[model samples]
Target: MFQHLLVPTDGSALSDAAVRTAVTLATAFKARITGLHVMPELHVFTHRIDTLEDTQERYAQLAERHAEQYLAAVARAAQEAAVVCEVISVTHDQPDEAIIRAS
Candidate 1:
């Protein structure tokens, strides 16, 4: 009954199971799958001579890398099941806000 299914993942084992479930559901319904990863903002500010922008950029890079890795795995799983899948990475201070906005 779903045309487009949005699945949020945190790269955890539990989340991996959920991804598998979503992929199964999408395949059954012949629906497109959208995998999302939300990068939570770093809040622990330390005066380590590094600028805030630098810290934020580093965090963003790390988040993007992890998200890509996680989504790639999910995409591969979907592909094996012959399902269409898309991946998206988002950054926000709050997980719920990022997911809502992405949706």
Candidate 2:
């Protein structure tokens, strides 16, 4: 009876299992799934200007890449099950709060 499902993932093995389960349920209910990943906000302290910029840039790139990689699992699972899927990513200091907001 569910029209839409929200699946939060962190790229963990446990999370992967949850994604599969969610997909199964969505398939049964003919529902669409939304996959969400919350990335930690980067915190760094450096005196060198170049180092700070480099670190921030690198962290941003890595965070985006990781979010994509983590959400890809959900996308693939949904695709295999022929279930519609959407993905979202956000940077937050508190992941639990982010998830709550997303829900």
Candidate with best lDDT: 2
Query: Against the hidden reference, what TM-scores do the models get?
Result: 0.86, 0.94
Give per-residue CA lDDT, model 2, range 35-85, as digits (tens).
999999888877777798889899999999999999999999999999999
lDDT of 1 by residue, 1-103 (tens): 7888888888999989988999999989999898998888787567775687788788788988999998988898889999999998887778898888888
Candidate 2: count the clashes: 0
C-alpha root-mean-square deviation, each candidate: 1.8, 1.0
* Runs in model 1 lying further than 4 Å from the true structure: 48-53
Candidate 1: give the clashing pairs.
none
RMSD of 1: 1.8
Off by over 4 Å in 2: none
